[model samples]
Target: MRTTIGYTAESIGYVVGAQGLVSFASQTFFGTEWGWLHNVVDLPSTAYLGIVAVGLALIVGGVKMRKTPQPQKAA
Candidate 1:
């Protein structure tokens, strides 16, 4: 049960991290530091890398959980 919750949180974190990274990239591509995403989400530049790292760790945890074998159940 805890593993399942971790998987769900990890999935969400991955998506949020991806969104922030892409938004920042898009802003830079347009020759600007401030993007519309900044208006919606207020993540500081310093925290961006940490957020991404956490997201990656969460995803790895989910994958590891999936790979572990489950116990057999009796009828």
Candidate 2:
């Protein structure tokens, strides 16, 4: 269960990070033209980088959780 949750978090993090990057790029380079995803859910300009940061944190945490050893069960 722990590993499963960790894997799920990692997957979600990748998606969030990718979305943030695209959104940030669009807004930064295209002069207020945000990514298509922004149309679905708009956020403040500051939140774009914040999203990327959160996504990276989640990825790191998930990787740590997935790598941790589980306790051995008694036979």
Question: Best lDDT goes to which candidate?
Answer: 2
| Candidate 1: tens digits of C-alpha lDDT, residues 1-75 | 656866786687778667656655655466455434566767656565565666677777777776677787898
RMSD of each: 3.8, 1.8
What TM-score number comes out for model 2? 0.82
Give all candidates' CA lDDT scores: 0.65, 0.83
Model 2, 1-75: lDDT tens per residue? 889989999988888887888888877777565556698778766678888988898899899989999999999
Model 2 C-alpha RMSD vs. true structure (Å) is 1.8
TM-scores of the candidates are: 0.56, 0.82
lDDT (Cα, 0-100) at 39 in candidate 2: 80
